[model samples]
Target: MSQATPPRSRRVPRAERREEILAAAARVFGSKGYRAGSLAEVAEQVGITHAGVLHHFGSKDRLLWEVLEYRDRVDVEHLEGQHIPGGLELFRHLVTTARRNADRRGIVQAYTVLTGEAVTDGHPAADRARTRFGVLREDIASALRTVADERGVDLAEQDAVRAASAVIGVMDGLQTQWLLDPEVVDLAESTAFAIEAILRAVLPGVEPLPDSPGASGAP
Candidate 1:
Protein backbone atom coordinates (compact mmCIF):
# COMPACT_ATOMS: atom_id res chain seq x y z
CA MET A 1 0.00 0.00 0.00
CA SER A 2 1.25 3.43 -0.93
CA GLN A 3 1.83 5.71 2.09
CA ALA A 4 -0.15 8.99 2.15
CA THR A 5 2.10 12.05 2.23
CA PRO A 6 2.00 13.96 5.47
CA PRO A 7 0.25 17.34 5.26
CA ARG A 8 2.71 20.16 4.89
CA SER A 9 2.51 23.05 7.35
CA ARG A 10 2.89 26.56 6.09
CA ARG A 11 5.43 28.70 7.94
CA VAL A 12 4.23 32.08 9.19
CA PRO A 13 6.41 35.10 8.42
CA ARG A 14 8.31 36.70 11.33
CA ALA A 15 6.07 39.77 11.30
CA GLU A 16 2.98 37.57 11.21
CA ARG A 17 4.26 35.54 14.17
CA ARG A 18 4.91 38.71 16.14
CA GLU A 19 1.38 39.93 15.46
CA GLU A 20 -0.09 36.61 16.59
CA ILE A 21 1.91 36.78 19.80
CA LEU A 22 0.72 40.32 20.46
CA ALA A 23 -2.91 39.33 19.93
CA ALA A 24 -2.58 36.48 22.41
CA ALA A 25 -0.81 38.73 24.90
CA ALA A 26 -3.59 41.29 24.70
CA ARG A 27 -6.21 38.67 25.46
CA VAL A 28 -4.21 37.24 28.38
CA PHE A 29 -3.44 40.63 29.92
CA GLY A 30 -7.00 41.74 29.37
CA SER A 31 -8.51 38.75 31.12
CA LYS A 32 -5.96 38.20 33.88
CA GLY A 33 -4.77 41.82 34.20
CA TYR A 34 -1.11 42.84 33.81
CA ARG A 35 0.24 41.77 37.21
CA ALA A 36 -1.54 38.40 37.20
CA GLY A 37 -1.08 37.59 33.53
CA SER A 38 2.02 35.51 32.82
CA LEU A 39 4.27 35.08 29.84
CA ALA A 40 3.63 31.35 29.79
CA GLU A 41 -0.08 31.89 29.25
CA VAL A 42 0.53 34.22 26.36
CA ALA A 43 3.12 31.91 24.84
CA GLU A 44 0.77 28.97 25.20
CA GLN A 45 -1.97 30.81 23.41
CA VAL A 46 0.39 31.56 20.54
CA GLY A 47 1.75 27.99 20.42
CA ILE A 48 5.22 29.22 21.34
CA THR A 49 7.79 28.72 24.11
CA HIS A 50 8.10 31.45 26.77
CA ALA A 51 11.55 32.27 25.47
CA GLY A 52 10.14 32.60 21.96
CA VAL A 53 7.68 35.19 23.19
CA LEU A 54 10.50 37.07 24.87
CA HIS A 55 12.53 36.84 21.67
CA HIS A 56 9.70 38.56 19.83
CA PHE A 57 8.65 41.15 22.43
CA GLY A 58 11.88 41.58 24.44
CA SER A 59 10.10 42.14 27.79
CA LYS A 60 6.65 41.99 29.40
CA ASP A 61 6.47 45.74 29.97
CA ARG A 62 7.33 46.43 26.34
CA LEU A 63 4.74 43.86 25.28
CA LEU A 64 2.11 45.54 27.45
CA TRP A 65 2.86 48.91 25.86
CA GLU A 66 2.66 47.34 22.41
CA VAL A 67 -0.67 45.78 23.28
CA LEU A 68 -2.00 49.17 24.36
CA GLU A 69 -0.67 50.72 21.19
CA TYR A 70 -2.41 48.03 19.14
CA ARG A 71 -5.68 48.76 20.94
CA ASP A 72 -5.35 52.48 20.28
CA ARG A 73 -4.52 51.81 16.67
CA VAL A 74 -7.66 49.75 16.28
CA ASP A 75 -9.70 52.45 17.98
CA VAL A 76 -8.34 55.18 15.71
CA GLU A 77 -9.07 53.02 12.70
CA HIS A 78 -12.65 52.67 13.90
CA LEU A 79 -13.06 56.43 13.47
CA GLU A 80 -11.07 56.76 10.27
CA GLY A 81 -12.32 58.98 7.41
CA GLN A 82 -15.22 60.21 9.50
CA HIS A 83 -16.35 63.83 9.55
CA ILE A 84 -15.26 66.21 12.26
CA PRO A 85 -17.85 65.42 14.93
CA GLY A 86 -19.52 68.27 16.84
CA GLY A 87 -21.26 68.13 20.24
CA LEU A 88 -24.18 65.84 19.49
CA GLU A 89 -22.06 63.95 17.00
CA LEU A 90 -19.31 63.58 19.55
CA PHE A 91 -21.78 62.25 22.15
CA ARG A 92 -23.12 59.80 19.63
CA HIS A 93 -19.59 58.72 18.83
CA LEU A 94 -18.81 58.17 22.51
CA VAL A 95 -21.98 56.13 23.02
CA THR A 96 -21.11 54.08 19.99
CA THR A 97 -17.64 53.59 21.43
CA ALA A 98 -19.16 52.34 24.70
CA ARG A 99 -21.41 49.91 22.89
CA ARG A 100 -18.44 48.58 20.97
CA ASN A 101 -16.47 48.28 24.20
CA ALA A 102 -19.19 46.10 25.72
CA ASP A 103 -18.40 43.51 23.08
CA ARG A 104 -14.61 43.63 23.70
CA ARG A 105 -14.13 43.07 27.42
CA GLY A 106 -10.49 42.06 26.98
CA ILE A 107 -9.36 45.36 25.49
CA VAL A 108 -11.49 47.36 27.88
CA GLN A 109 -10.17 45.51 30.88
CA ALA A 110 -6.59 45.97 29.77
CA TYR A 111 -7.17 49.71 29.35
CA THR A 112 -8.90 49.98 32.73
CA VAL A 113 -6.24 48.02 34.59
CA LEU A 114 -3.35 49.77 32.87
CA THR A 115 -4.75 53.23 33.52
CA GLY A 116 -4.89 52.48 37.24
CA GLU A 117 -1.35 51.16 37.17
CA ALA A 118 -0.08 54.14 35.22
CA VAL A 119 -0.88 56.44 38.14
CA THR A 120 2.29 55.35 39.91
CA ASP A 121 5.14 57.74 39.18
CA GLY A 122 7.75 56.41 36.74
CA HIS A 123 5.58 53.56 35.49
CA PRO A 124 6.58 52.56 31.96
CA ALA A 125 3.33 53.66 30.34
CA ALA A 126 2.66 56.60 32.67
CA ASP A 127 3.81 59.22 30.20
CA ARG A 128 1.97 57.53 27.37
CA ALA A 129 -1.27 57.42 29.33
CA ARG A 130 -0.92 61.09 30.30
CA THR A 131 -0.28 62.05 26.68
CA ARG A 132 -3.31 60.06 25.58
CA PHE A 133 -5.47 61.90 28.15
CA GLY A 134 -4.14 65.24 26.98
CA VAL A 135 -5.05 64.44 23.39
CA LEU A 136 -8.51 63.28 24.43
CA ARG A 137 -9.07 66.46 26.43
CA GLU A 138 -8.09 68.59 23.48
CA ASP A 139 -10.40 66.69 21.17
CA ILE A 140 -13.31 66.97 23.60
CA ALA A 141 -12.66 70.67 24.13
CA SER A 142 -12.60 71.28 20.39
CA ALA A 143 -15.88 69.44 19.97
CA LEU A 144 -17.44 71.37 22.82
CA ARG A 145 -16.34 74.64 21.33
CA THR A 146 -17.79 73.66 17.98
CA VAL A 147 -21.10 72.68 19.50
CA ALA A 148 -21.29 75.91 21.50
CA ASP A 149 -20.60 77.98 18.42
CA GLU A 150 -23.17 76.07 16.38
CA ARG A 151 -25.83 76.51 19.07
CA GLY A 152 -24.96 80.22 19.50
CA VAL A 153 -24.33 79.54 23.20
CA ASP A 154 -21.79 81.78 24.90
CA LEU A 155 -19.62 79.00 26.44
CA ALA A 156 -16.31 80.21 27.78
CA GLU A 157 -13.11 78.29 26.89
CA GLN A 158 -12.57 77.44 30.51
CA ASP A 159 -16.13 76.20 30.78
CA ALA A 160 -15.61 74.03 27.72
CA VAL A 161 -12.39 72.66 29.25
CA ARG A 162 -14.24 71.85 32.48
CA ALA A 163 -17.04 70.22 30.54
CA ALA A 164 -14.51 68.16 28.61
CA SER A 165 -12.95 66.98 31.87
CA ALA A 166 -16.38 66.08 33.23
CA VAL A 167 -17.22 64.15 30.08
CA ILE A 168 -14.04 62.05 30.39
CA GLY A 169 -14.80 61.45 34.08
CA VAL A 170 -18.30 60.27 33.31
CA MET A 171 -17.18 57.90 30.57
CA ASP A 172 -14.36 56.31 32.59
CA GLY A 173 -16.48 56.05 35.76
CA LEU A 174 -19.37 54.43 33.89
CA GLN A 175 -16.99 52.02 32.17
CA THR A 176 -15.63 50.91 35.57
CA GLN A 177 -19.14 50.32 36.86
CA TRP A 178 -20.20 48.47 33.74
CA LEU A 179 -17.13 46.28 34.00
CA LEU A 180 -17.95 45.42 37.62
CA ASP A 181 -21.68 44.81 37.05
CA PRO A 182 -22.49 44.48 33.39
CA GLU A 183 -25.97 43.14 34.04
CA VAL A 184 -26.88 46.18 36.15
CA VAL A 185 -25.23 48.79 33.97
CA ASP A 186 -25.98 49.56 30.33
CA LEU A 187 -22.78 51.39 29.44
CA ALA A 188 -23.82 52.85 26.10
CA GLU A 189 -27.31 53.83 27.20
CA SER A 190 -26.11 55.27 30.48
CA THR A 191 -23.38 57.24 28.74
CA ALA A 192 -25.85 58.60 26.21
CA PHE A 193 -28.23 59.66 28.95
CA ALA A 194 -25.48 61.42 30.89
CA ILE A 195 -24.22 63.14 27.76
CA GLU A 196 -27.68 64.32 26.90
CA ALA A 197 -28.06 65.77 30.38
CA ILE A 198 -24.77 67.61 30.05
CA LEU A 199 -25.80 69.01 26.69
CA ARG A 200 -29.13 70.20 28.04
CA ALA A 201 -27.34 72.16 30.74
CA VAL A 202 -24.95 73.68 28.19
CA LEU A 203 -27.27 74.15 25.22
CA PRO A 204 -30.96 74.06 26.08
CA GLY A 205 -33.22 72.54 23.41
CA VAL A 206 -30.26 71.05 21.54
CA GLU A 207 -31.16 67.92 19.61
CA PRO A 208 -30.57 64.59 21.30
CA LEU A 209 -27.77 62.21 20.42
CA PRO A 210 -29.08 59.43 18.21
CA ASP A 211 -29.83 55.98 19.64
CA SER A 212 -27.72 52.98 18.76
CA PRO A 213 -29.59 50.76 16.34
CA GLY A 214 -30.45 47.28 17.66
CA ALA A 215 -29.00 48.06 21.07
CA SER A 216 -30.25 45.72 23.82
CA GLY A 217 -30.78 48.70 26.15
CA ALA A 218 -29.77 47.63 29.68
CA PRO A 219 -28.84 44.09 28.85
Candidate 2:
Protein backbone atom coordinates (compact mmCIF):
# COMPACT_ATOMS: atom_id res chain seq x y z
CA MET A 1 0.00 0.00 0.00
CA SER A 2 1.16 3.54 -0.74
CA GLN A 3 2.10 5.62 2.25
CA ALA A 4 -0.57 8.10 3.36
CA THR A 5 0.18 11.72 2.42
CA PRO A 6 0.54 14.35 5.22
CA PRO A 7 -2.13 16.99 5.47
CA ARG A 8 -1.10 20.53 4.62
CA SER A 9 -1.12 23.15 7.35
CA ARG A 10 -3.94 25.66 7.26
CA ARG A 11 -2.94 29.27 6.64
CA VAL A 12 -4.01 31.94 9.09
CA PRO A 13 -5.71 35.06 7.79
CA ARG A 14 -3.44 38.06 7.38
CA ALA A 15 -5.13 40.25 9.97
CA GLU A 16 -5.30 37.46 12.48
CA ARG A 17 -1.66 36.56 11.88
CA ARG A 18 -0.61 40.19 12.35
CA GLU A 19 -2.44 40.36 15.65
CA GLU A 20 -0.78 37.15 16.76
CA ILE A 21 2.62 38.54 15.87
CA LEU A 22 1.89 41.78 17.69
CA ALA A 23 0.87 39.95 20.84
CA ALA A 24 3.93 37.74 20.70
CA ALA A 25 6.12 40.75 20.17
CA ALA A 26 4.51 42.54 23.12
CA ARG A 27 5.26 39.65 25.42
CA VAL A 28 8.80 39.32 24.15
CA PHE A 29 9.55 43.00 24.48
CA GLY A 30 7.80 43.18 27.82
CA SER A 31 9.89 40.43 29.33
CA LYS A 32 13.03 41.47 27.47
CA GLY A 33 13.47 45.18 26.80
CA TYR A 34 13.07 46.29 23.17
CA ARG A 35 16.84 46.61 22.78
CA ALA A 36 17.22 43.03 23.95
CA GLY A 37 14.24 41.34 22.31
CA SER A 38 14.80 39.86 18.87
CA LEU A 39 12.47 39.32 15.93
CA ALA A 40 13.58 35.71 15.83
CA GLU A 41 12.23 35.24 19.35
CA VAL A 42 8.89 36.76 18.34
CA ALA A 43 8.82 34.56 15.25
CA GLU A 44 9.67 31.49 17.28
CA GLN A 45 6.79 32.21 19.60
CA VAL A 46 4.45 32.61 16.59
CA GLY A 47 5.75 29.48 14.87
CA ILE A 48 7.18 31.44 11.94
CA THR A 49 10.55 32.43 10.55
CA HIS A 50 12.24 35.79 11.17
CA ALA A 51 11.74 36.56 7.49
CA GLY A 52 8.02 36.01 7.92
CA VAL A 53 7.90 38.67 10.64
CA LEU A 54 9.73 41.12 8.36
CA HIS A 55 7.30 40.31 5.55
CA HIS A 56 4.45 41.47 7.75
CA PHE A 57 6.04 44.49 9.46
CA GLY A 58 8.87 45.49 7.07
CA SER A 59 11.42 46.12 9.84
CA LYS A 60 11.83 45.72 13.57
CA ASP A 61 11.47 49.48 14.01
CA ARG A 62 8.15 49.44 12.20
CA LEU A 63 7.12 46.42 14.21
CA LEU A 64 7.95 48.24 17.44
CA TRP A 65 5.85 51.23 16.40
CA GLU A 66 2.99 48.92 15.46
CA VAL A 67 3.24 47.24 18.84
CA LEU A 68 2.99 50.64 20.54
CA GLU A 69 -0.09 51.51 18.51
CA TYR A 70 -1.58 48.13 19.35
CA ARG A 71 -1.17 48.95 23.05
CA ASP A 72 -2.99 52.26 22.53
CA ARG A 73 -5.83 50.38 20.82
CA VAL A 74 -6.10 48.09 23.82
CA ASP A 75 -6.35 51.12 26.13
CA VAL A 76 -9.69 52.23 24.68
CA GLU A 77 -10.92 48.79 23.66
CA HIS A 78 -13.47 48.67 26.49
CA LEU A 79 -14.93 52.16 26.03
CA GLU A 80 -18.28 52.70 24.43
CA GLY A 81 -17.73 53.69 20.75
CA GLN A 82 -14.02 53.24 21.54
CA HIS A 83 -13.90 56.95 22.28
CA ILE A 84 -11.93 58.54 25.08
CA PRO A 85 -14.01 60.73 27.37
CA GLY A 86 -13.42 64.42 28.12
CA GLY A 87 -14.03 66.79 31.07
CA LEU A 88 -14.66 65.08 34.40
CA GLU A 89 -15.50 61.93 32.54
CA LEU A 90 -11.90 61.67 31.37
CA PHE A 91 -10.63 61.44 34.94
CA ARG A 92 -13.17 58.76 35.72
CA HIS A 93 -12.17 56.87 32.62
CA LEU A 94 -8.53 57.06 33.64
CA VAL A 95 -9.29 55.63 37.08
CA THR A 96 -11.35 52.91 35.43
CA THR A 97 -8.39 52.11 33.20
CA ALA A 98 -6.06 51.91 36.17
CA ARG A 99 -8.44 49.49 37.84
CA ARG A 100 -8.61 47.41 34.69
CA ASN A 101 -4.83 47.50 34.25
CA ALA A 102 -4.21 45.66 37.49
CA ASP A 103 -5.32 42.51 35.74
CA ARG A 104 -3.26 43.22 32.61
CA ARG A 105 0.28 43.08 33.94
CA GLY A 106 1.80 42.03 30.64
CA ILE A 107 0.57 45.05 28.69
CA VAL A 108 1.51 47.36 31.57
CA GLN A 109 4.93 45.78 31.74
CA ALA A 110 5.43 46.24 28.03
CA TYR A 111 4.41 49.88 28.26
CA THR A 112 6.69 50.63 31.17
CA VAL A 113 9.66 48.81 29.64
CA LEU A 114 9.34 50.48 26.27
CA THR A 115 8.83 53.90 27.83
CA GLY A 116 11.98 53.54 29.88
CA GLU A 117 13.90 52.36 26.86
CA ALA A 118 12.67 55.28 24.79
CA VAL A 119 14.50 57.72 27.05
CA THR A 120 17.86 56.37 25.90
CA ASP A 121 19.83 58.42 23.40
CA GLY A 122 19.10 57.63 19.75
CA HIS A 123 16.44 55.09 20.70
CA PRO A 124 14.21 53.97 17.86
CA ALA A 125 11.04 54.66 19.83
CA ALA A 126 12.13 58.06 21.21
CA ASP A 127 10.07 60.10 18.79
CA ARG A 128 7.01 57.91 19.22
CA ALA A 129 7.26 58.13 23.00
CA ARG A 130 7.73 61.90 22.92
CA THR A 131 4.73 62.32 20.64
CA ARG A 132 2.61 60.12 22.87
CA PHE A 133 3.47 62.17 25.96
CA GLY A 134 2.76 65.41 24.15
CA VAL A 135 -0.64 64.20 23.00
CA LEU A 136 -1.57 62.88 26.43
CA ARG A 137 -0.52 66.10 28.14
CA GLU A 138 -2.59 68.13 25.71
CA ASP A 139 -5.60 65.89 26.14
CA ILE A 140 -5.40 65.94 29.91
CA ALA A 141 -4.83 69.68 30.02
CA SER A 142 -7.83 70.22 27.76
CA ALA A 143 -9.92 68.07 30.06
CA LEU A 144 -8.78 70.06 33.08
CA ARG A 145 -9.71 73.29 31.35
CA THR A 146 -13.13 71.90 30.54
CA VAL A 147 -13.74 70.97 34.15
CA ALA A 148 -12.59 74.38 35.31
CA ASP A 149 -14.88 76.11 32.82
CA GLU A 150 -17.86 74.04 33.87
CA ARG A 151 -17.20 74.89 37.52
CA GLY A 152 -16.97 78.65 36.71
CA VAL A 153 -13.36 78.59 37.79
CA ASP A 154 -10.58 80.14 35.79
CA LEU A 155 -7.66 77.76 35.25
CA ALA A 156 -4.55 79.24 33.73
CA GLU A 157 -3.05 77.36 30.77
CA GLN A 158 0.26 76.81 32.50
CA ASP A 159 -1.46 75.53 35.63
CA ALA A 160 -3.50 73.10 33.59
CA VAL A 161 -0.36 71.85 31.87
CA ARG A 162 1.43 71.43 35.18
CA ALA A 163 -1.53 69.56 36.70
CA ALA A 164 -1.70 67.33 33.67
CA SER A 165 1.99 66.53 33.98
CA ALA A 166 1.55 65.72 37.65
CA VAL A 167 -1.31 63.36 36.93
CA ILE A 168 0.64 61.56 34.22
CA GLY A 169 3.75 61.37 36.36
CA VAL A 170 1.88 59.92 39.32
CA MET A 171 0.18 57.27 37.22
CA ASP A 172 3.40 56.16 35.52
CA GLY A 173 5.41 56.24 38.75
CA LEU A 174 2.78 54.13 40.48
CA GLN A 175 2.86 51.62 37.66
CA THR A 176 6.59 51.19 38.04
CA GLN A 177 6.35 50.72 41.79
CA TRP A 178 3.37 48.39 41.54
CA LEU A 179 5.14 46.28 38.94
CA LEU A 180 8.03 45.85 41.33
CA ASP A 181 5.92 45.05 44.40
CA PRO A 182 2.23 44.45 43.88
CA GLU A 183 1.86 43.32 47.48
CA VAL A 184 2.86 46.75 48.71
CA VAL A 185 1.33 49.16 46.22
CA ASP A 186 -2.35 49.28 45.33
CA LEU A 187 -2.16 50.70 41.81
CA ALA A 188 -5.86 51.35 41.21
CA GLU A 189 -6.79 52.78 44.60
CA SER A 190 -3.66 54.89 44.84
CA THR A 191 -4.21 56.29 41.38
CA ALA A 192 -7.76 57.24 42.20
CA PHE A 193 -6.69 58.97 45.40
CA ALA A 194 -3.92 60.90 43.72
CA ILE A 195 -6.17 62.07 40.89
CA GLU A 196 -8.86 63.11 43.31
CA ALA A 197 -6.34 65.06 45.36
CA ILE A 198 -5.03 66.80 42.30
CA LEU A 199 -8.52 67.77 41.23
CA ARG A 200 -9.40 69.04 44.65
CA ALA A 201 -6.25 71.14 44.75
CA VAL A 202 -6.79 72.53 41.29
CA LEU A 203 -10.48 73.33 41.73
CA PRO A 204 -10.85 74.36 45.34
CA GLY A 205 -14.41 74.85 46.73
CA VAL A 206 -15.95 72.84 43.92
CA GLU A 207 -17.98 69.80 44.88
CA PRO A 208 -16.52 66.55 43.72
CA LEU A 209 -17.07 66.01 40.04
CA PRO A 210 -20.07 63.78 39.70
CA ASP A 211 -19.61 60.64 37.71
CA SER A 212 -20.94 60.73 34.17
CA PRO A 213 -24.11 58.73 33.60
CA GLY A 214 -23.36 55.01 33.82
CA ALA A 215 -19.71 55.75 34.51
CA SER A 216 -19.83 53.69 37.67
CA GLY A 217 -20.96 50.72 35.63
CA ALA A 218 -17.86 50.64 33.44
CA PRO A 219 -15.87 47.47 33.82
Number of the top-ranking candidate, with lDDT as the measure: 2
Work out the TM-score per prediction: 0.75, 0.76
Residue range 67-121, candidate 2, lDDT tens digits: 8788667667666777677888888878877776676675576678778989999
CA shift at 85, candidate 1, in angstroms? 5.0
Point to the candidate with the largest TM-score: 2
TM-score of 2: 0.76
**Model 2 per-residue lDDT at 201:** 78
Candidate 2 regions off by >4 Å? Answer: 1-16, 23-50, 58-65, 205-219
Q: Write the per-residue lDDT of candidate 1 for residues 18-131, one digit (tens) a residue.
A: 887777887787677657889998877777679988998899877887887776555445453533255566677777777767776666776787788899989877898899
True-vs-predicted CA distance for residue 164, candidate 2, Å: 0.7
